[model samples]
Target: MTLQFSGWLPGGPTRPTTARRCELAGGEGAVVRYDERADSLDFAPDTGPHPHGLAVVTARDGHWCLTNLHAEDTYFVENMESGGEFVKVAPRRRDIPIPFELARLILPVPRGAGMVKVFGPEPHYLAPSALSGSAANWPRLDEDCMYFRVLVALCEPQLRGCPPGAVPTVAEVIERLGDGRPAYRISRAAVNHHIDYLAMHKLRVGEWAGAADGKRSYWKREAVVAMALRSGLVGEQHLRMLPSRRVTARQGPGPSRLPAPPPRSRR
Candidate 1:
């Protein structure tokens, strides 16, 4: 068997977001899935000779480690470009790092999505689809805050796990960020423009509204939020930045350090 990719790999660096293969740890690697049921990464064996060795890392922990099933280990051929949590997979051969041939054979699943599928000798774990990865897609900051805000609205509430909140409409976004009572508010029309921006800049934006039967159409919202969370755009900490939690911090009075000044001169 060989790798089968969705063919969503990027060629080189893309603006606002860089796309160097070697930039992030073995960033040149392909995206793979994490099988929660097997507790192992899913890898489909290929016809070509395997590479020198496999390098693995995990999001469960930020640590990187190596394990070799054979002494032929020389290079680390694993791909990490997808930025998902990495898991160690034993290499069939130990000569080169992950072989380039595997690139075509490996299908990219969403990084850290915890997808599960049971099939091969090893149960097939579900992975996020290639569309789940959008390292090359960058939103225009100044012009697309609305879009970014949309992602924040759709994604931030239940970043890692589902939290209490509704799928906010564009009106809520416009009012929340717009500071509706203030002069610098955003208009509903502008919010529409930004939603359009999500199609290209955000991962899984379009999928939310058109999901299959019974699944929450809002799954796309979760998908994009998870993507944003993984990619570092809007994190758990950023949730406080939301308008609902708009409390200003106050500094308490401190101890006196200097002597009290003489009564003010009647100058």
Candidate 2:
């Protein structure tokens, strides 16, 4: 469909000024509004998770429309000028939530030359700098950043035999995870819920050194360490991933690295 852009500015022509019009060739020519201030193109309100979403890209060649079928990762690329639709998409990556991913793609695209748009799920109105913050960029991709880090924090200390079996309950885990560092405001119930989920799957979270008298869930003092070690989610290299506050004050900036052995005299 032919998209006509008209605008009237200060000291402009008397007749209706026709800005460059772009042809929309894809799925359906969705009636869309671009909120420049908000930097979002949305078709509906934040009602809930729905299928209808649209994103726009502009280029010297013309405008292109993007559409998606929630059933799968495949999206249709519409050639606005020819009204031809072709599907071109990599498999929907697990790391990318289709809706939030729009920001990652939108920003890097070279402006004044070409544009590409994407739509799906709830609307995310983000600016070019959305990548600056941790949450926006997802520093921890697939893993549950909350508990996973707490578990990783325990690794060095527990391996070194420093105050073994410290945190026994969800509340205690929360305390140690917070202690002095900024924390993810997680609750006991949430921890318990996730513990139950892990247990239901019979996932081994490494060997727990703490006594298992009567706790219903498998999340013991060393459960996080066990999980990290066994699943290879967190390693010694990831010690820096731990929060500063989680590190015991006595431990300095963080846990100490095991000192290397003396070199052989013959060498």
Residue 114 displacement (Å), model 2 = 69
Residues 49-148, candidate 2: write the lDDT tens digits. Answer: 3344333332112223232323444433322211111235433221222222121121111111112333322333569876565454212323455545
Q: Please, what are the lDDT tens digits per residue for candidate 1 over residues 188-246?
A: 67766665555435454555435434366345444555456455566555455456635
TM-scores of all models?
A: 0.32, 0.28
Query: In angstroms, what RMSD does candidate 1 have relative to the true structure?
Result: 16.8
Top TM-score model = 1
Top candidate (lDDT): 1
Off by over 4 Å in 2: 1-141, 154-156, 159-168, 181-184, 202-224, 230-232, 246-267
Question: Whole-model lDDT for model 1 versus the true structure?
Answer: 0.40
Q: List the residue pairs that clash in candidate 2.
A: 24-80, 25-78, 25-79, 25-80, 26-78, 205-226, 205-227
